[model samples]
Target: MNRFVRWLSASALALLATIVLLPQPAAAAPIPCGHDCLGISRDAICWEKEWCAVPIEIKGTLPKEGYALPYRTADGTASAPADYTEVREGVLWLKPGGSLQLEVFVEGDSVRERGETFLIEYLDREGRVVATATVVIRDGV
Candidate 1:
């Protein structure tokens, strides 16, 4: 019985040592901002005479199946037809690790005024706004 007990203790110690000393698989690097994060590259842009194309950056893990979402612009301090050309509704097709740009037409004039803002909104299939990016239009002149 004493011999058996000693053998059992030794086996247990060997197993513990193996578990403690053995290398483990390295942990995966954490993704920045978490999964399903999408955003615009710039928070603001200077209004050009003709138009400005804003780049939308897609980050984090994207859906493998891909999807199409609705996007549109909403007036803030800036009004359409005078400040910008309104995008009533547009379709945005997205894939894993992909990016796209949005073009906004700006009406230019010699008149001096304060800065204006507008919203670029991303919506779901039901037309509910999901994500939004505010763009500040700086006066070019």
Candidate 2:
């Protein structure tokens, strides 16, 4: 499985993806508001952006293991289950006067370090309003 994950992480758009670790305030400051947090690596941070062909990636680092990744529409419509290790990636595309939304959830079994989630949104080329993405998190390590 590790091999497969490595392959997927490199061969697919995931290579063009950007996953970041999100730890809850119980451990540090709240994200989405410019929190000074660090990932196991430097690629674990996303300042936030909206609407475009750009890939929207949310990463969850479970201390012990288990995790999930679901991608849904801004209004919670059109969804696809894609929870995995290594990394997860979601592509967003919107037209003028449209938007996209998503929520990323992460849960693990480790003291002071379980997981993190993020609400990601993207804007169209013309910078118009659109939809959002839906993300769901669960517990299980």
All candidates: TM-score? 0.61, 0.21
RMSD vs true structure, all candidates: 16.5, 19.5
* CA error at residue 44 for candidate 1, angstroms: 2.9
Writing each residue's lDDT as its tens digit, candidate 2 over 1-141 gives: 999998887877554454334443343211111122211101122211211122333233222322222222232221222221211334332222232222233323333322233333333334332333323323233
In the predicted model 1, the residue pairs found to clash are none
Residue 48 lDDT in model 2? 17
| Clash count for each candidate, listed in order shown | 0, 19
Encode model 1's per-residue lDDT on 33-78: one tens digit a residue: 2247454444457574767766666655556765566778899998
Task: Give the runs in model 1 whose Cα sits over 4 Å from its true position.
Answer: 1-42, 61-66, 95-98
Worst ten in a row by lDDT for model 1: 26-35
